[model samples]
Target chain A: MRWLNTRTITPLLFMAPVLVFAIVFFFLPVGFSLYISFHKWDSLSPPEFYGFTNYVYLLSKDPQFYRTLVNTFVFAGGTIAIGIPLALVVAYSFSQSRFQTVWRSIYWLPMITNIVAVAFIWKFVLNDAYGMLNRGLALVGLPGPGWLTNPSLSMFSVIMVFVWMQLGHNMLLVSAGLQSIDDTYYEAARIDGAHSGNIFWDITLPLLKPTILFLLITNFITGISYFALMMVLTEGGPAGSTNVTSLYMYNMAFSDLRLGRASAAAYILFALIFIVTLIQLRLFRRGGVEAHN
Target chain B: MADAGGIVRSRTLGSRALTVLKYTLLTIGAIVMVAPFLDMFFGALRTVPERLARPPVYFPQTPQWDNFAQVFREMPMLQWGINSLITTLSVTVLQVTSSAMAGYALAKFEFFGRMTAFRFVLGAQMFPFFLFIIPMFFILRYFPLVGGNDIFGKGGMGLLNSYLAIILPFAVSWHGVFLMRQFMMAVPSELLDAARMDGAGEFRIFFTIVLPLVTPGLATLAIFVFVYQWNEVIWTMTVTRTAPNLQTVPVGIYLLRGAYVEEAKMSVQQAAIFLSILPVMIAFLFLQRFYVRGLTAGGVKG
Candidate 1:
């Protein structure tokens, strides 16, 4: 039998586990989530078919939902704007510096650590009264604001911590990008007596555009979906100032038993991410950036 | 004449100044990156009296190293560590084997539905984990014929409190498959054909020949999966909220926050957090090259 032949059967055999997992764990949950989003489910009773009410409630009535949406955007935007540039600069230095491996290993520690550990470490470091951060600020003759206690500063604190956690990761990507640029470009520029700043702005920046674009898109996507740090650190506290959409959704499903509503929230966030990614792809295409390396 | 060191090595006064400035900034950045870990290490050593002091001592006088031991004494840390190891190891092994097998198939085989299957793997990676949290929870909770549940999946909690719930969802990583496929595509087809001509069965050739060829790729993916599954909190915490016996290190420490109310207890919490991260930290330090490769692969592609 052709199906029983080694070539055909072997491939099928190899693919069996992944295929089964994709169906049961990946595809089924996605479809099930969509299905559940239309109903009111509390796990204690049979789900009631509520049609679009869950979506409607979130869109038209939920102020917390709106706040979370805004908070998520802010967190994502702030991290991309601040974190990417910081990573690029650090990576630029990293690519140029000696003792590269040591610096990289040190910086990479937080990236590999657990999110809970990272949150707690920073939570202690940013303590209002006795935090090392405040103690150091006092040393420098500067006042230390409550990093996690102040509503306005809580989201920013979480964002900074998130950025710190991600710095090494993005820096490495940027460093790779920087290293991949041909030395010939720099050689030619230097022969013409181009200033270091001119070379950086004119040649280095242009050559690194693809890598930067990649970082921007990926980091933004991660930032938008990220809530673990906030969950462990602030627990979306200080009057929900740090409550991003994912944290809000987590509470909704687990704490409030609003499965349908939470699913609706997740789908809405997914849609936003989907649309943004598409727009990013379109922009990249227009900018002549090839993503498939 | 300028050497081939490029413009970065220009020996101008400005470049020298820039070099000095770069080192200064990077040194500060590295300090920022590592200081908190040092703080954690030191914080874990503070005595209860020191912790309860009005100003809150930053460093320990005697360095209560026993607090790390106390973490095990007071809490079910050994259980948590064992659970973490079991779930993480299971997920890592399953993901690596499944991804390697599937990756080899897609890279080498020309099956009827290969393209479709490959496309599904690519598309699957884009779906965020949060999207599946709700439905997957129910799916595990109502999984039939397991965890005392009947065929209709209604009699009991199903796999909700079991290790299966933690391990099963992560069995097959889409990114791992994609990465392995990328690695496998570089392997020459002639090698496999020669093995076949040598009277080798496909499974034998695969296990002995193809798997060895992709060891580096497998290492990269293994470290990647190990770190991720070890640090995974959300899904595990959700399923194990009522089943503390199954909770991993991070989840156990987080869920046990109520036990750590006092400042002295906070030191224990910090120690626990430190210990929770130590294994992965040690692993990453030793295998950082593989870790970096895996991370950059995901970062650039994702």
Candidate 2:
């Protein structure tokens, strides 16, 4: 009974599991990875300290690394540039429509489904010879290009599928943001003879800036780290056009057995993402988006 | 009176037109979103001849219900399903329990390093999982005394080729702890204080009073983890690449794509995909509100 105070001991006891996990899974792995990045090791042999060579090779010597970096940026930038606006439009429509729940559930179907399933479904739909998209194109007298097989179009195919999968979730976020706006804003705008388009642009977009920024930052982070879809859909194939950095790192570590180089690649990507995130935060603060939200 | 009525009528007409346009666009978008799934189901039922035809058949002349059964016969569908359930369920339960305990501590208890612990959780979430996969894989592989390894962790695939490999790294989620902490902060301190005054133990207070109150948060986090882990491919595929016995459904399907190269086998692959997606779809259908709440609360990283 004396040990029951709501102070140091009780909280420490409760936090023990998480503390252990943080040390073991979080801290240990991160530290070990950083150490590995500095040394050369294959699983069979002891690690040899190699000093910045791994980073040097990846940054300057490796052509594939540069290609993957470009591909990763393309995927992330394309998804944000296209997906966020598309999602906002759909969400704006959804927020204004009837049977919102039903529409939301339908759109969310792809989001809940696994990446493998989405990739495979798209695989079937984008089949060069007899797929649904091609069939539809044929029906309308339009030629269907190779979606996943052509090097030129493979990255586009992945981006389109990625956007489609992410649309519902982003739409939900935007819809939530849309719902939070005060009805008085719309009413006042209408009273001033503002058209719906003017009201949306002037009132909704300004008020929704926080949500949009949140979506942009998070989606950019996710898109950069994402590789499962590329792994399954293209396996970074079609002349390696679809290869992103994460997937490239995975192959380097596993397939190429260059554990040291893979860790370095991962850290470089992490640094890039971290810096971008900081920049986004600074921009948001400067723009006063946080103040409004 | 006539002019005022005419203005009102015109305004109503404009609004009605907008509504019609909105519904039409949304309906088309919904169709695009769902039609691929319909195509998958139809593709799974198409006969070999129909599939091989020049333009390809959009609909099956006769629905091949047998493809679903053939999936089991041709592949280890049952094993993959069981593995997915075991790993997903284990990760979910462990994550929820760990997060709740840690969250409760951070929310209610006054302790040293409390701010640091919370900050660690926040910073850790920003560390994308790609950073951990390389070292974590070796850590599991070289773990001493678990899988016939020596005292020095030298041999025998330490924890690889087992459910533990998949479940261990995910046992505690930083986001889950953060989310739980946020939820638990709202729980009144007075209730726990009253329970303590009535001679209840800390564990008892948590289980009986605190836990029940945060069940919504628990459920939200549980479903979120469950769906994510169930669909997790990269980590599972990496460790279980050679261990087919432990491959989950998504990993199994992707790895076994070579088996479905023939047109006849394509239907089987599509059927397998359908089956793999079924469980999460059913769960989402039932518990969508909680999922939405979870997504909005976290606001990122699904």
Cα lDDT computed for each candidate against the true fold: 0.90, 0.91
CA shift at B171, candidate 2, in angstroms?
0.4
Against the true structure, candidate 2 reaches a TM-score of 0.97
- Poorest 10 consecutive residues by lDDT, candidate 2 chain B: B293-302
> Candidate 2 — which residues are off by over 4 angstroms?
A1-6, A289-293, B1-7, B300-302
TM-score of each: 0.97, 0.97
The total number of steric clashes, by the backbone 3 Å criterion, in model 1 comes to 0
Q: Please, what are the lDDT tens digits per residue for candidate 2 over residues B1-302?
A: 56968867887888788888888889998998999999999988988888888667778999999989999999999999999999999999999999999999988987778988888888788899999999999889888898989988886889998899999999999999999998999899999999999999999999999999999999999999999999999999999999999999999999999888888679999999999999999998899999999988855221
Residue runs of model 1 more than 4 Å from their true location after superposition? A1-4, B1-11, B298-302
Docking class of 1: medium
